[model samples]
Target: MSKTDVSKKALLSVNDLCMYFDSAGRRIKAAEHVSFEINEGEVFGLVGESGSGKSSIGKCIIGLNRATSGSISFHGTELTGIKSRREYTEKMRDIQMIFQDPMSSLNPKKQVGQIIRDALKIQHIGKDAKERDKMAADAFRRVGIPVEYADRYPRSFSGGQRQRIGIARALAGKPKLVIADECIAALDASVQAQIVNMINEIKKETGTAFLFISHDLSMVRFLSDRIGVLHLGYLLETGTAEEIFREPMHPYTRKLLGAIPRCQCRILLRAANHSVRLSATTLR
Candidate 1:
């Protein structure tokens, strides 16, 4: 890829994005004037405290929530403006999401393989039932699940295993980008490591861009190529993981970094070196 290619490459772009909601007859701004770009195969981390509008941005990107104002573009085409139904479907097929709770996200009534196949079917990935089943099996295997587990319900697997199923379902369509919105926050430390490692392996295999939304700065730094700090619905800082960690520019960013006790931080950062684990109490 040349510099020209790099300059022109962007999987998702947001400019002056504003999301507002009506609360008790008053207008509440969730995200205000937010602007950023997620490049091809880039893991752009959105870090913030509770109610900082981190999830709002992710939702807006995928059309889960409508934007109040401003522009959002995907692959250089305006998503917030206009598009045909087929065009929208084709573009959205390449975007997937892994929610925070696998249990809630996965249907209890459906078998694991069925769950993955639903995604494949939605994306029109496979030509027939046989091919779809094979795709589901391949997805399960890619995330380290035995093919037999596909027959079982979500209740049979542990939390980590369920999350892996969630990951497999998200990857079933071979998406170009994935939004992992606090996906690992609920898991234990060891399980967090497992999920993170699996995500890394899959990202390597697929060259997928990830909008990794989370409050864990340490973990975000570990998994993200570029990290953005959001405070009070504002983007306070954004740069490479090294730049953000080595020298944060904003006061809010500095305060978040300061929350880490130096000695404890060294240990925590060491664990984060493995690319998982919360390792922080407050990030708001």
Candidate 2:
């Protein structure tokens, strides 16, 4: 199904997700009472400034860091309540993460092909060694990376290429939900656009829901079906992309838009309008 026709089925839900840290005997509230739900086959963007707790929420969902309180559920199963090892393993396969820095996110020692194959093995996706190899090659091709370069290491590829490899690794697991935590922050402008377009294509083709965390509003506007504005550990506002851009309810949201360059702001507005038109035409 297309994004415009997305069903109301909730694929992931977070309620009162509060992640706190203690640094130097001081309590730091990274995220407080933040709540949102992602529907099946939807792209949900979480946009905020630096230190606004965007990555903290994504990390909490993926089990990198446990929340100090609150609950996170996937397909009605609370992440913290899984009683069986088998069930926990299933959950891990269902949700995958693409880290911010592709340079550091990948294994420096392994070949790019091996990296993807290793994930498939860990997730128990392919039946045999030959099958895993084929899947790994397919993953590389899917991300626009040449299969011939599979033997090369991550350090050998450019930043954009490395990010594509990271994406390939994430997709090799065939996850239902992927958390992209600032995945484009480290890339150049042209490469960032390419990755964004690639991600948009992946979402459309695979129907994989995404929690795209970023500080770039324009990129989020281009990618997100629904957006939640986060600031200083609180989710300030949420709505469809059209609503957030056309008529921002929160003052901070307006401030963010105002911060964009005038020419870029016009481009963003036009893009949003264009998206709305396309959606309407598709519905008709």
Off by over 4 Å in 1: 1-8, 81-87, 261-284
What lDDT does model 2 reach?
A: 0.88
> Residue 120: error of model 2 in Å?
1.5
Q: After superposition, how far is residue 113 of candidate 2 from its true place, in Å?
A: 0.7
Candidate with top lDDT is 2
| lDDT string, candidate 1, 1-284, tens digits | 22432674788889999999888999878899999888888888999877889998899988888899999988777888545676777778888999998778889999999988887887778899999999899888999999988899999999999999999988888888899999999999799988888887887788999999998777887788888888767888778878888988886676677555345867667544432223243231
Residue pairs in candidate 2 whose N, alpha carbon or C atoms collide under 3 angstroms: none
lDDT of candidate 1?
0.83
After the best TM-score superposition of candidate 2, give how far the Cα of residue 42 lies from its true spot, in angstroms. 0.8
TM-score attained by model 2: 0.88
lDDT of 2 by residue, 89-164 (tens): 7778889999899889989999999988988887788899899999888878889999999999888999999999
